[model samples]
Target: MSFILFLRQLGLSLAEIKAILTSDYSEQTLLLNKKQALQEEIARLQALEQTIDDQLQQVNQQDTLQVDQPIHLRVLQRLPFAQDFDLSVVETIDWQPDWMLRQLYYVINETDYAICMATPAVSDYQIDAGCYVTTTIEAASGAEFDSALAAITTHQTLPLIGIEMRGTFLSPGKHLAVKILGNRKE
Candidate 1:
């Protein structure tokens, strides 16, 4: 019609002059590659949310301690040569030992149970460092075969390769405690 009115006075039109004569920048290079893949997926989810808040602040930091010693029912047999683990759940730990270890685990009074220990770590994997220990016991219900026969007439100084019979279900008094499970693996 006048060369489309001289290409609409030069502002072009006929489909922007056929997309600038075919050099069609694929819709602005697909919106700049979808805005650089959403800014690298928001910088890899903010570096995985700061690596899950620094592993939840290293499990909310811990270095607890609670001792007065008095409770009994011990057994770990031996651990001088080290290297042998199998805490085959002999159940009885209704969970309770975080309130600064329950106010010193209620000041060793007729302790229903508590025998947490750890130190092994010469490389066979690792554990030492703050090497832990928490004593307190009083069992009954098949108390894991009397704690493996009181680790052969007990006289320990921390040498009972194994004895996992934790407790916390007595909230009534008396004795007959139970939780004697087992495990094996040399």
Candidate 2:
């Protein structure tokens, strides 16, 4: 076949072939650049996500706390008033080394109190108030303080149920029954 005829038979119109090759190369270059950009973006996003996950893990580890058991404590004070408080159980952890302390505290009326009740009170009917394990727990402010105060205010204040006033100078009432605090096991 003549060279010109052979070219025609091969389906090559010079200008058309050149145009197709140029466009194909251009598309390929564009696709490669897009792939690189996408890879960079994906890497950046992954790094950001990893950083966020690490922060979350740190926070969870720092604040992770639980209550091991319930603690019941009683306090006798000179304050002449009937009051009962219930506080949220924050940290139920072993005290320092061996003993376990179940912390219960409340916050209310600007007063905060904490009680580290002993796990399994020594006496079922009576909790030894003077025991080292059953001491008054107090807080500064914030969540801890609020919790402590709440514990003391939630319980009902029983009006003078039974009381004994002494001396011939006993003003008016013969008997006064103040509110007594009681605990319901959780």
On the 0 to 100 scale, the lDDT of residue 49 in model 2 is: 69
Q: Score residue 158 of candidate 2 by CA lDDT.
A: 22
Worst 10 residues of 2 by lDDT: 159-168
Using TM-score as the measure, the top candidate is 2
**Model 2, span 1-186: residue lDDT tens:** 464454455455877545645665565654576578778777667655644553453334322212234334332111212233223232333234322111222211223233232334442223323212111223433455335434544553321111011111222443221112233233
lDDT of 1 by residue, 52-118 (tens): 5433432443222222232233221222222222243323333332312221111011212233332
Clashes per candidate, residues 3 or more apart or on different chains? 7, 22
lDDT of 1 at 78: 23
Candidate 1 backbone collisions, by pair: 76-160, 77-160, 78-160, 78-161, 90-179, 90-181, 141-176
